[model samples]
Target: MNRKPADTEPVTNAPEWTVSSLSGALKRTLEDAFGHVRLRGEVTGYRGPHSSGHAYFGLKDEGARIDAVIWKGVFQKLRIRPEEGMEVIAVGRVTTFPASSRYQIVIESLEPAGVGALMAILEERRRKLAAEGLFDESRKRPLPFLPEVIGVVTSPTGAVIRDILHRLADRFPRRVLVWPVRVQGETSAAEVAAAIRGFNALPRAMNGPTGPVPRPDVLIVARGGGSLEDLWSFNEEVVVRAAAESAIPLVSAIGHETDWTLIDLAADLRAPTPTAAAEKVVPVRLDLLAAIADLARRHRGAMMRLGERRASDLRALTRALPSADNLLAGARQRLDLAGGRLVHMLGAGVRRHEARLAAAGQKLARLSPLVLLERARARWATAAQGLGRGFAHGIERRAAILTRAVSRLSLQPLRLRAEAGRERLTIAGTRLANARAARLAAERARVDNLWKLVESLSHKGVLARGYAIVLDSEGHTVRTRAAVSEGMALELVFADGKVGATAQGEGAQPATRGRKRKSDAAAPPPVQPTLFGGGE
Candidate 1:
């Protein structure tokens, strides 16, 4: 090989490279040789996650297998998780692992190969979240026209935040709180989710210690535009759920206009870009001021036109009105004519009224006040006498009542008290006498009733009523026919005496309870003629 000693002092025998140096050279050669390349293969043996957040897996086709690794950053930015047997196209540079003497592609970006695998996963998640009403239009809140304190959840160092702040400043200066978070990579989804929740959990009012952060009236979750892989954190379920559940209105400015994430659908509002989100939040200050001025101008012009129109109308009315001088002249003419007539009429009327008044005065004078006064005085005297008599009667009656009351009151002393006791005793005696008399009356009445009952029940009484009592020879009463046997002797008692009797071989005849029967020859009642020609 020919060597030239020039520009760089001759490269000394290609510099004896050690193993580390050789590996270094190979790594650089591989990286530069491959540059950025895309390859498609099926993922295999993807066990799960590593504590360091890197993923190790195998990419294989039917013919060959190669170990592959994705660093935490690149793996987290992947739209869909790498599952075993998924076909993916990875874009990255080839690098070697010195210990294992193996080469693999360090995936810078990854996607489903010739397939909508990520899209399918995204759609599935969307459907699931939508079913849960997370994406409901009804749940979407209206963004506040101007937030008091706007919270931003994004990478603190990104241009997105700068763009947002600049736009907001240009439109309307607002109080903004930045919740610094990772916009992409492994912890980005979790950090974004945590930031959203933290903003929501902040106290609404800051009277006391507001702690490190005050609650935001509206939250903006934003990131700059990139590949779907770059925006994958926003699509994460945790991030989307956090956005959906935020009571504070959330604005999703996730990426450029064409880039959409799950958070965009879940947020209260979606801005095409971070700058656009700022614009959406508040109107341009100058524009608002101009609008106000225009309204004021319109209002003033309207008022002026109204006032001019009213003034013109007033002028037209004034022109149509009769002159004050003419009105006064007409009124004066009428007043003059009426004044002369009124004066003439007044004179005539006064003369007539004066004549009538003279007559009336003469008539009134003919009536004597002395007569009327005398009559009134006479009536007054009668009324006065009556009133005096009534007063005297009332006084006498009152005096009598007072005298009685005084006399009664005077008697109610020692002697009167003793007399009252005696009176009470006498009253007790009287009540005792009345009670004895009532008892005597009741006893006499009872005795008289008993006597009457005895007399009524006596045999003499029964005989007197034409009834008899029968007795056996032994003097026992035979009350029933069955008790009287044939040939048995019986005794009958009457009010005056008793008689002996015998049963003539037959039971005793039943005594008739009524008076002797009276009978006549059979004869029918005479028939009477009916007025309707029927015999009765």
Candidate 2:
């Protein structure tokens, strides 16, 4: 790859050049070479903008330095003025003066490089912290509007502490716990983090008996305006994380209006300056008083409106109301009429109810069961006497007939009947014996046939004849496959004896298929025979 020539290399190789010409050439070359360049260095001698609308400054570090200038137009555009020891970026053309044989940059635009670089770094850190959900809006805590005890983390003697105290005193006159800490240099961030943690560790009820204790309701991390490097401690990751992780809400106020640091992004709130942070932390006394007066005025107005509405309603209601004299007169007339009617109706109802009660009592008296029963009992007694008489007469008639029957019987007739009875008994005995023998034989045959039928129908007989009669524990015959499910114990009755067996899967059949013929499915399902035979 081809490379470009170095800037230090001479443009032309000529030997007939004078010292002044060489210097002029070098100055021109330098101007051409370094035009519109941006250089970063620490500000050493920064002169504030003059009436000529120009700023003069010298940027230097420990090892190297440069002279810089910025026009008034550019200086006016800066939000924060440059100060000595401030680091800055100078965008200008590098030009050499032949008289002094020195090169300097004529700045068209100037910015504090430290602030820009810090801003860039803060932006990057913000993105990373946001990705980690540390700077998420959801993670941000709302500051208490009326904090009982406000905590301040700042330098002990700095303007930030004084401003916060004055503002807090003016706004609420509440005790602010100033956790003194360095606001700059190496130990500032550590001290700030420790102060935050310390406040957070305090018990929530630390406020005194009559007043709210020193538990910080809100934390203010503040510092006065300074160079970027002077304020860099607040931008440290420890400080940012501490502020971000604080249980109490944190407000970051570092440097001036143009300074933005990583701590600002991590904190719940960011204020431009310490005084501004204090102003944000609490309401101004005058503003609060004015607001209270305004609210009181609004409240009074609202009450007046409400009272007017109520009065209007009352007027409407009064207009809608009936006249008291008329109403009372009408009510009196109604009451008089009602009283007269009520008296008449009550008297009539009483009379009517009395008559009805009298009639009911008479009817009840007429239907009294005691009188009816007495009468019935008398009739029953008469009927019973008549029945007794009839019974006596009937008994006497039967006795006469029996006595005549006895009189008609004679000894000769009795003897002939006795002889005839003996002959007939002899003949009856022979016939009875023959008939009994035939009947016994026939009964034996019938019993044998019945036994045969019963045996054929019996579950024991079926099991003996190469058929199995399975029954469940309840003695219900297992007719269908499903009735004899696997793992079921069954009674297998044979002609001679009975055996218990369990059904395996192979012998089970679905009950649904045999549901139609369920009645004839098994041999009477094994039933407990009663002594009298089948169940009644």
Candidate 3:
């Protein structure tokens, strides 16, 4: 079925198109492919409008991107200048130029993609430079407090140079040698580096020509605000190294307050702007003059005070001369008096020491244990002799007394008395035996009677006589019938046995009532027994 339709149609082989025709179609296709396209990307290598009033740069994303162009007519309408690495949304028409046969977007309008992209780029660049020791504190040089001459490197035709010049004039008005250099574009980094080296290499005299001819004690690199790409010359490694290696102290002033460049870190000091760099490098003329005047006044005041102090010191010294002489004479007299008193005291002390030494020697001799022992031995010998004589005398007297006593106590009488005493002792011993036997028999009878009394008083004897003691559960004897009710269980205790019994039908009540009735009758009153078994 398809072959039948092909036969019905006419076909011929021919040349397709001309080069121009193909190119035209290609251009149209390319235009249609990207025409009126909206692109979001960061701007890199951004060059602002040139004399031709055209901006050229690349628009890039994370993966890929393309080149872009904007004529001055459209660029001038932009509220904010586009900077490198600044993400932007660009609305433009795509076109392919016939000359180069290249495709690009001709931007009509643009706005920031977002602020985050700029911050990210800043942070990334900071990290990269920081890792390379470009921002190391050790690399920074110290600026001279009062530089003899400041070398300025900046655009010869820009507000940056004029601002710097005016500020220097207003401040120290010192001679500043200008190193005219391009502060932007391709050759900017090279020009700035050359300017730094030139200043550093100049001799003191050649730096300037008259009136304290300028010697570059310091160098200032200055620039005005622009896009990141415009200010990129300051961030170039060459410019950074030049500033770091400069023999003269360098100050970096690039862009606005928020702009940071690698050269700023490498320089001795970083100023917010070109005008600030000039102000930082020199002191104000009026302020310095005032400071000098104040110093002079202080010096004069100090000199006056010093002169007054010297004069007062001289007067005091003149007055003190006579007093010093009097003090010397009085000191001599006091020394003489002190010497006499010391001699008298020494003489008295010598006598007192000698007496004390003699007393100490005498006490030492008295306290000697040998002397005391010798005296004690002599006393002991005398006491022994006295004791012997007393003992001999006492023995003689005792002998006489003993002899008289013996004579008084005759053996015949003593023997008779001893025999009589023996006979009496024999008789007494016989009587004592008889009395002991009778006492023992009497004690046995009293023991038997005590046993019988104890048996009669024993609880067992009472039980044997058909009497039972009732005790409560606590083992205390119940003395009265009222102590336990009719239904209360009671423990009856004998001498050797006990039984629990409940009071039934009040069996003891009649006995209690009969006793009460008998007590109520006018019978002879029953005597109560005391604890000692005495009738009361």
Candidate 2 lDDT? 0.72
Q: Which 10 consecutive positions of candidate 3 have the poorest summed lDDT?
A: 513-522
Off by over 4 Å in 1: 1-115, 207-213, 305-536
lDDT (Cα, tens digit) per residue for candidate 1, span 1-536: 98866786845666687998888889889988998888889999999869999999989999998888899977766766777777888888888998877899888877777537677667777999999999999999898876888999988898998998999899999999999998977788989999999888888665546555568889999999888778878888999999988999999998899999999999999999999999998889999999999999999999999999999999999999998998899889999999999999878966865675576556544433333334444665575567558656765675566556657676557346546655765675577558756755764565455446545644567899877788764444566676666777788888778888888755556444312222111223233222222333
Between candidates 2 and 3, the one scoring higher on TM-score is: 2
Query: In terms of TM-score, which candidate is strongest?
Result: 2
| lDDT of candidate 3 at residue 117, scale 0 to 100 | 59
- Write down the lDDT that model 3 would get: 0.74
TM-score between model 1 and native: 0.41
lDDT of 2 by residue, 1-536 (tens): 97777986768766798879989899888887876788888777876777798887787878987777777777665433566666667778998767877777787765556556556555665787778877777878777777777888888886678887877777667668888998875467778889988889888776667765558888888888877678777766778788878989999988889987888888899999887877787776788789999999999999999999999999999999988897899889999999999999878966865675576567646544344334444665575567558656765675566456556888577557656655765576566557756755764565455456556655566667787666665454566675665666679866667899977778765334213233542223233222223421
TM-score for candidate 2: 0.43
What's model 1's overall lDDT? 0.78
TM-score of 3: 0.40
Task: Extract clashing residue pairs from model 2.
Answer: 53-72, 88-113, 207-212, 207-213, 481-509, 482-509
